[model samples]
Target: MTLRGTVRTSYEVLTSRFGPPTFPQVDDGGLPAEDSTLWLIDTPAGRVHVHNWLDVTYFLKRPAAETRWSIQATDDAALPWIYKSVTGSTAAFSAGVHEFSRYSTRVSLARGYVTYLVQRMIALRERGERYDQGSREHRHQIELSRHVGHMALQVQQIVHDVEWAYADDADRRRWTTLPMPQLADEPESQHWHRWTRWTYRPVPTDSRPEGGDPDLVGMLRRRARDQVRFRDRILPANHRGPTREGKVELYDEHIGTLLTLADTALPDTVEQSRS
Candidate 1:
């Protein structure tokens, strides 16, 4: 299939709307050899084909697909629009680069997201006064802040599950007690550094650095909760914006980062009922 634009989203997101995909030999308890985990859907423009592409190496590691799947269509001829129509996922229509199998834990994924959100929030603060209420820029401001609140909620309720998976509080603390990653002037670069170190101390390894300062779990959690309160203070003045006309722009800003993070802790992916 000719690689077109990609939608990095959850398997459940796909299956919820399209039913189970072409799960070839799923009952055999064997890893799929070909691109067997596939989906086909009809849209006004054309049929959309969704698959795992070349990310098969990790399939055995997970009998289930990743919390997200990078869908590369067979054609780009108005297919991006069709994809948005069918899957309701954020899509970018360009023959994008192929994605590889990436490994990430729930805690690391959430931590990386926290890094991106805080840094992005700082950037937004620098320009918040510039955005007029009910304007396009205002929408960005509202959405970003609201999502921060949403993320903080995710951290306390969902990311905590990952922490609890360990045998004891020390081990749990070890998972979240990471080191700061070096920040960048650019968002993507900063996100990569934050997530890649994902573990900066020898929680198991020390890979990325953020000025070498230790990242305390309790402090980070408190910081995120503070953002939730901050959003509430500002939300009364902000709405999703007059309409949904250009709301997906944040996807451009944050979606790619999300797929990169692949925070399985996110509840969006596990919504499927296997039974």
Candidate 2:
């Protein structure tokens, strides 16, 4: 196929030689695998894929509304995961405000782990421990410690804001639904997940949405509000039953200076491998 056109690239010579194109084939894995000699590229909204030559012209001619929907779906799915994590935490134990409190406990553990690591690294440096040739261990420890500290601060701020999750009856009166955000996926070790939080507020009869739309909106708002209230009123109040305590076992731990060596030596090892 002869390629032509700059911003608007075309390959019309293919049709002149091969007649018209057949349907694109789906790969064994069920993915659309275009086999055309020349494919039109698309990177809009991070959709890095090739399209059949015909699709390029078709997409260009499609209505803006269709393109807007496509863009929204791609961009919406690409948002960061951290927001999902905490929001999901609340949703898992629907109607249990205590569940949110429990999430605060996990946050505390993350904060403490970060603090302990930072202190341990600092103590190692103060004791004149050996550093790698590039001193990457020292630098990495510092950078990780800083990042952990920042996350801790942000979590602390969010947790301290009582209004973010709690509302008095007066405050609740303003809305139809409560937000019940849930994690989109399991957290990565201790990383965040992406989630959506929905909060509903009451609309006056005069200001309510038009005809059928208002009814649909009202239903959604009520569902959201009920879920939020369920979390707040149900989860935490029912905690003291049998108090099933599990047996605790402790194992002797090792003081591995080995990790320190690996952490220090790894970069050099990778460099050697490349050489």
Where does candidate 1 stray beyond 4 Å? 1-106, 131-140, 167-243, 246-275
How many backbone clashes are present in model 2? 18
The 10-residue segment of model 2 with minimum total lDDT is 245-254
Model 2 residue runs over 4 Å out of place are 1-78, 81-134, 137-145, 163-275
* lDDT (Cα) of model 2: 0.28
Q: What are the lDDT scores of the predictions, listed in order?
A: 0.44, 0.28
Model 2 lDDT tens row, 162-274: 22234446654443254455544543222221121142222334443311121222332343344345434533544542211100000000011111111221211112334
- TM-score for each model: 0.29, 0.20
- At residue 229, give the lDDT of candidate 2: 51
Predict model 1's lDDT versus the native.
0.44
Candidate number of the best TM-score: 1
